[model samples]
Target: MSDTKDSDSDSGTGRCAGCMESTSEKFRGFLNFLWNPEEKTVLGRGGKSWGRILIFYLFYYAFLAALFAVSITIVLGTLDPNEPRFQTRLQAPGLSIQPKLDASIKRTSDVIFTAGQADTYTQYTNTLTEFLKPYKENQATLNNCTNGKVKINQQYSMEKPPPSCRFDLADLGPCRNEPYGYDVGRPCIFVKVNRIIKWYPVGFTDLSKAVGNADSNAPPLKDVLMARNRAYDPNRMYVSCYDVTSGNQTYLNTAAGVSANTMYYPEDNGIPFKYFPYYGAFLQKDYMTPLVAVQFNKVTRNVDVRVRCKAYALNIQDNERMRIGYFTFTLRVNE
Candidate 1:
């Protein structure tokens, strides 16, 4: 009876231990099969399974690549190369002031200059040259354009061949001189109206009378005194410049000494009406914005003069942020 009891206890203990070891072996075998691809059997599958997986991933990646290419093609088809598709938010384009930088300053919205600084003045003048590069006139492009106004009434005409008004850069006159009037403390401020399709100025009629009626506190529009000689156009836009700081009595006395004169290129008052209804780049590839150069003649050395230029139009609107129809900059000719 004792021998039988001892035998039974040994058997019970040994069986439990043996079962545990078997389970551990099975688990280790499963891990080796998953971890080692070099092993004959893997994930309970034949060698063909490995080849199948590689083929599956190759097809999957190729399909994803093809889908991406198609998506890009669709997006490009919707875009217009010449004009923006959506312009409702920016109904009126802003006025651009050029030469608004120096060599040290890569880009800026305001201008800073020093009298007798030829290097700084030259740098600014070069910028103007580059800006006008697109508008570089040649015989081929000017075939349809003439000295007078050219208008396009049909979309098909724009498609067939559009017309552009001749804007001879020579009209810049004294402002376009070497050093650009910087040597004599007279810096040229180039103003351009941003391009917007089918937009026309409303308050351009009798610009001389309108300029004459400028704010009494501001300096007189002495430039308009010569308007009597030139033929004024009702369809063109008008520009006005004033000393915004003239409101202060102390500043006004000092500001009066600086002669600020407005000189419009191609014509006086504003950009010509002939350059209107800007078609897309496809129609007018060499199109450029109508520009006005205001020469601040006799700016006092070492004085900080703040000036503002505004475009007047009955239909055109103005914004407080200087984003549309207006811009302000400081002109300091420090020696």
Candidate 2:
């Protein structure tokens, strides 16, 4: 009985080995379906089936790509390269004052000055230099703009527009001095008017008519023409810088410690007439907004004073709630 049981156990073990060998061969055959050129099968599908799937996916992606391209073409067709689609989006252009907020300050409109803090002031001065690089001065193109006026008559002309008026960095004068006046707690404020295409100054629309009449009663027109005549008229635009803490005055606020003095340099209170009717970047690649530097001669040290600079122009629209056509910033000097 024991010898019969031993023979039966050997036969059972042989059968199990045969079954394992058969399973291995089946797995190998299954793998061959993934890449079997001889059988014309790929990934368990015949050549015809695989070709159909490839064709289907190719057409599917091709249709998606074609739809995407058409959508982009239709969207781009609605836009005008020269004119802004939303003309009424902002009724008035904005005034940008710089030495913009330092990286540490999250608020975009405020400037903090610490007397004797070279790093803080250095960052601002460096930004000013970088911003003014395009307007540094180009003697070669100076002749293109005669007496600081570059005329642009039409839009989309194949020929390039006239060169922009030269706004040399030297025009900054004392504001360009070393340290930029922050060391002494008197920081320089640069003011630039936001560019609006085809928006002319509303206040001076009748400037030519006003210029023709020499009547003293027309003080507004006389002032406009006089401003146009002066090499650099300081009164073209009435700009006022005021200390917010002083008081809530009218539309214009005069800077504290500045009532008896003028803080504007080079006479032009702010943006000059030369940079008007902004031609798009393509027409004038080197065009830069004219910058006016306002120096605070009597800013109190270690005090926080809110400064607001307003540019009064007939064409410059103002918002009751927003600082439209003007800029407001906080000035704090620490000892």
Candidate 3:
């Protein structure tokens, strides 16, 4: 009888150890799924408490689902079915107003003694304004063309110059730097810019009227250097002009900066042009010159640009025949 009782006790002890091991492993897995366990999984004499806990979990999940559903419903209700509201959309703020255009146009007798003076501050404000009027309108039309549902891209008759150009140039060097534009393979450099400009307001209220026959001559910079004071020195520039991709011969931003001997090629990499998307106009013009920069920065879109071109007016006196001109007109968009 004693042996029988001892044997039965040993058998029950072995079974309890096995059951405990299995329970430990299963509970570990359950704990992994539940993250933190606050209540038990079963119910009865031992698990009536667990039953209450399970009910609590069910209520918690139901509450979370209801809150989520309510949030989604509210968001959907705010948007009109006819008016598409893209969750992911971006807009460029028309052309950023550079503050430089706010300056006065010197309005001299709008006549060119030599062809060099036609695009000067006293002359080209009227010329470029007329030339660029159509361009400004075209740009506006392109910007307004899209409404979240459709994506509109503006393809120019002229694409950004090749790997060496913002678009294709008739030639490899600065667009038409020669009297005859010839593009032989020359090493081309590229720089992209974005920034801010202060407008000083050119007085022509109607800048869009096409004025003179912009007979494509030498690039304005080339013309200025060769014509203004006739170069014996390495520092001066010839006026070189090219038609921008805006599909017009001129826009109001083109004007000549007066220099006694030579105009400076702008090298400003440290300053950022956050508000100016059209900042490349100067960069392209300056890149071909003897302008040297020790460092440069990059331009990104959608942020405000806060940079200034160190536009130095060359000191000139009439007795000195070496007056070179630099184009210094600013472009403004009225939103």
TM-score of each: 0.70, 0.67, 0.22
Model 1 misplaced regions, further than 4 Å: 1-46, 78-81, 102-104, 132-152, 156-159, 197-232, 248-267
For candidate 2, the per-residue lDDT at 196 reads 70
Where is the poorest 10-residue window by lDDT in model 1? 212-221
Please report the TM-score between candidate 1 and the true structure: 0.70
Lowest lDDT sum, 10 consecutive residues, model 3, at: 179-188
Error of 1 at 127 (Å): 2.6
lDDT of 2: 0.62
| Candidate 3, position 84, lDDT | 43
Task: Kindly list the per-residue Cα lDDT of model 2 for residues 1-335, writing each as its tens digit.
Answer: 99999999999999999999999999988889677878777787897897899999999999999999999999899997766788776677777887775567453656676877897677777777766655655534543343433334655543756456666666677886667788876778788777777654434444333221111111233443243353324325545555556553211123323342325655555455556667666566666766777777666666667676666566554554555755667877777
Instruction: Give each model's whole-structure lDDT.
Output: 0.63, 0.62, 0.28
Candidate 3, 298: how far from true, in Å? 21
Candidate 1 lDDT, 9-39, residue by residue in tens = 9999999999999999999888987766666
Highest TM-score model number:
1
CA lDDT of 224 in candidate 1? 46
Candidate 2 clash pair list: 202-315, 234-267, 234-268, 241-255, 242-255
